[model samples]
Target: MTATPVLVLLDHAADGTLRPPVRELLTLARELAGDAGVQGVWAGDEDVAAAVPALAAQGVTTVHRLATDTDVHLSAVLADGLEAALAASGAALVLLVSSFENKEAAARLAVRTGAGVVTDVDGLEVQAGRVVAHKTVLAGTWTTRCAVSAPTAVVTVKANSVVAQDAAAPSSPQVVDLPVEVRASSTRVRLVERTELAGSGRPDLGSAHVVVVGGRGTEGDFSAVEELADVLGGAVGATRVATDEGWIGHDAQIGQTGVTVSPRLYVGAGVSGAVHHRGGMQASGTIVAVNSDPDAPIFEIADFGVVGDLFAVLPQAAAELRRLQG
Candidate 1:
């Protein structure tokens, strides 16, 4: 009999390395599996199975490697490979990160396997006869606990919500052969030139221990906030408005439509703080807000508040932090 598997989605980067979202999902997989076994699935240029040993510290026992190559990058192929792996491994659950590229894989995999699919779950627990995960609804105002409708469940969890669990020892990932079917579909998005962004020497937003965010209230300049983030040795974040206005990159946006993060500390600058935006970053362990206006909504959630303009506060804070560090 095949061993039970809990598939964790793997992110293949331009450098042919796994991204943190995949590791985050692996950590969650270990949480759900507990003493149970886990098997990971990845469809990419190289075998993701090679990284399984790193995941084993979190209790992952096996890795399913898909050797198929695709002319078009579609989630269908991922799901196709997953079905084969699930059937072969007898997985009780499959874990995924809530990302655009992987959504189709989770959706199609569920349909093909007749499994219950859950999306954007903030937390997971075992209750009654099924597994339960919490989902925030109505822009984080209402929280709902959703139970999986099937014994075999498919889950898409938000990024930065879980800790990265490590595997045992230095054992490398054992490779398992996967079966996949390549069919001609209208969904043909080809892979073009892929490149990595220049390293800013900041931690990843989704995985950072600390995050510093700025918004429209920054008065169209974030040099102050950026310096403060550097001082804190953390990643910089921005609101949707900052990204929309091109004040910051889209990757830096923090909101419902942006990257979800749960850091030890999060500092907001000049942000009024909308519910949608808060829905993503509210899970942060601590919140601090600096704004010219005391009435900004961000101050309500902030553990520390400074009622001053970000432009004035950030530079002073940065300089002070540098002096303190010396």
Candidate 2:
């Protein structure tokens, strides 16, 4: 008996290049999909042609391109396209990169299709013919495993949950255009104007494999934190205090009320590891903390703790890393 295929929501950059997290999702999908094979759902306006080769290399046998000219930026509209793709592909499971926007899309899709939805999942597996998703809850204090008993399941997965690997045997995937009928209600809230933030050379804070965070101890100076993050080819984040003080953009804030990250490595510089901030990143695979205060709470959870001034320690660390690379 052929297993039902697994579908991945393909996210891409403006240039139509597939995002790194999408590749990770595809790799995980390949593992979950045995004989059923892996498929992609492309809902963006960018030309799907540019992403086909990369998708094919990731073991995707089929691409369900949404055949619609309407804007899919809205959650409801994107859900419509996803529903069409799900119907055409007969995929029992759909995986998406976890983000605020994608969580809205997942919820909308679940409401439209009666599918079970799980968000911020760090791990997924097929157990006893059921899709089991593993995630943290209650401010990362509790870990839980949930089984999707519904006929169809939609899961939003955290980045870096799996390492992306090319298929042992690649296949030239066939692109199938699926028609979408946009509901008028979906367009009720039209986007007026969009302002793009200036690009930082570093990776996105939410999905980066490595993240460097600064807190109140930075004293409104993030130079050391940024330098280390840049040296490590990672993203820079800030505690709420840093943002509230206008030391950094609110977008960089990482806390219970801000972005939740589950990167492979987390480096907190001058951060006190407040409950709100720790709730955001406690799930990281490896955590390192640097602070002048030996009694800082962050030391409690850090795999490696250095009781030193961040300004003094971070630059030395960056210099050493650069020298070693040289």
Q: Residues 230-265, candidate 1: write the lDDT tens digits.
A: 889889999999999999889998887788877789
Would you give me the overall lDDT of model 1? 0.75
Q: List the residue pairs that clash in candidate 2.
A: none
Q: For each of the candidates, give the backbone clash count.
A: 6, 0
lDDT of 2 by residue, 227-272 (tens): 9999999999999999999999999999878988888999999999
- In model 2, which regions exceed 4 Å deviation? none
Deviation from native of the Cα of residue 78 in model 1, angstroms? 1.6
